[model samples]
Target: MRVGLTGGIASGKSTVSAILRDLGAVVVDADLIAREVVERGTPGLAAVVEAFGDQVLTPEGDLDRAALGAVVFADPDARRRLESIVHPLVHQRGAELEAAAPAGALVVHDIPLLAEGDRAGSFDEVVVVDVPTEVQVERMVRDRGWTREEAEARIAAQAGREERLAIATRVLDNTGTPEELRRAVEELHAELAARP
Candidate 1:
């Protein structure tokens, strides 16, 4: 089965994806592949540097993610331009990973932005890691050292709770302890493996 796992920023999607991985599902992570295709000399990084200029780079010459983010988040046109540059490359690599998984193994593609409508339909099943908005803000602050305002801004950039959970074939509520989350994922793994 091709499963799409998604969630908002700091919503514990990666933790759930890891649990799925330990159960032997082949996970094709979009963020990991995005970083690979954009590493320094690649065409992706070169395109980003050309479009955004040296101001988007650190003194050490690496891409300064914060600088590039400030531009994209502040300007819709700029954001679209950045997405245009990165998404195709990321999607291509993700597809290759999924295609290369063993014939009988389940492939789980964990894409952070899958709730944006059209993106969710590609997979046979969709899973979303959900938590309360306040809990999300708290976790981001405590774990990521993000201020309340910054945490809210990052959350605002993604689909709201309604949009996220509305598409879920399985919703893993991660508001409690880690053990609870593990139990939920274990249940899901068994259920998914049994499906034709």
Candidate 2:
């Protein structure tokens, strides 16, 4: 089964992904693949440099994510442009990883932007790691060191909670304790393993 897992920032998607990994699901992490595609000297890095200019690169010849993020996060056009370069490559890598799974393996694609990109339809099932907006904001502030405004902006940039939930085949509510979250993942993992 190819499942897409997603949630808003600070919504515990990472925790769920980790639990799924521990439970033997082959997790294809899009964020990791995105970083790999743009590593120094690659065509993806070249493309990014060409589009955003050499200023986006560090003196050590690596993509300066912070520099690039500052530009993209503030400009919708720039963000789309960056996504245009990264998303196709991320999808290609994800497909390769999915194809590599053992027969009947539970392959979970941990795609942070699945809903935002309208790519949920590609998965056999979609599991949304859900938290209330207030919980999300609080976590971001408390854990990620994000100021209230920054946390709000980051949340606003993604697909809204209702939109993500609307597309979910399963919802893993993360408003509870870590043990509760782990039990939920374990239950979901068993259910997924039973699939044909």
Which one is best on TM-score?
2
> Against the hidden true structure, what lDDT does model 1 obtain?
0.89
**Candidate whose lDDT is highest:** 2
Candidate 2: where is the Cα deviation over 4 Å? none
Candidate 2 least-lDDT 10 residues: 150-159
Indicate the worst ten consecutive residues by lDDT in candidate 1. 113-122
Tell me the whole-model lDDT of each prediction, alpha carbons only.
0.89, 0.94
TM-score of each: 0.95, 0.98
Q: Report the backbone clash tally of model 1.
A: 0
How does residue 133 of candidate 1 score in lDDT? 90
